[model samples]
Target: MPFTIGESVLFFGIISLTTIVIRFLPFILFPENKKTPGYIAYLGRVLPYTIIGMLVIYCLKDISFTASPFGLPELISAAVIIVLHLWKNHTFLSIGAGTIMYMLLVQFIF
Candidate 1:
């Protein structure tokens, strides 16, 4: 595709519009002043864990224990995630730190 003004604007406009709707839809559905339904609140609480579980499963799916790295980087990073999460109890911090550690290990050591 040509990087022309009209084409770029059309593409970005669609993306921006979609982003706005996705962001605003939550607020529209669950107003801050109003109480959320029990089911929705329950789902909100469990969704993070569900996503994390899915990511862990996906990450481990392609691992080859017999290969060179032998999954050491992944295992060590997972340990970091577990330890950080347990010690600090901050999900984002744990995930970010673990990701950085994994990247460093893979790039430098394994």
Candidate 2:
């Protein structure tokens, strides 16, 4: 189906307005002159670790110990991530290295 010119213009206008509203809403809600709420500050501090924990559980939820590969690739990749993070203290290096290791294991070794 094709939109008429008026319909396209209306659609784009709504999208542009929505984008502007979203961009400015944060500053409107939490102006620089006012102090942020305690609960919001606490969530900002806590959500990152909570999200990381949730992601770890999500990533490890499907391993099969009795299967052909026996979850070795996943376990090895996780260990690599842990070791790299501990040794170098770099989140991106550990995660990127672990992802590459998992892909290599699945494609060529497993």
Model 1 RMSD in Å is 4.4
Per-model TM-score versus the true fold: 0.56, 0.54
**Model 1 Cα lDDT, one tens digit per residue, 1-110:** 68799989989999999999999997899998999999999998999989988987897987789988888999999999999999999989998999999999999998
lDDT of 2 at 86: 96
Clash numbers, per candidate: 0, 0
Give the Cα-based TM-score of candidate 2 against the true structure.
Answer: 0.54
- The sequence of per-residue lDDT tens digits that candidate 2 reaches over residues 1-110 is 38999999999999999999999997899888999899877886999989999998798889888888888999999999999999999989999999999999999999
Candidate 1 wrong stretches, greater than 4 Å:
33-35, 54-71, 81-104
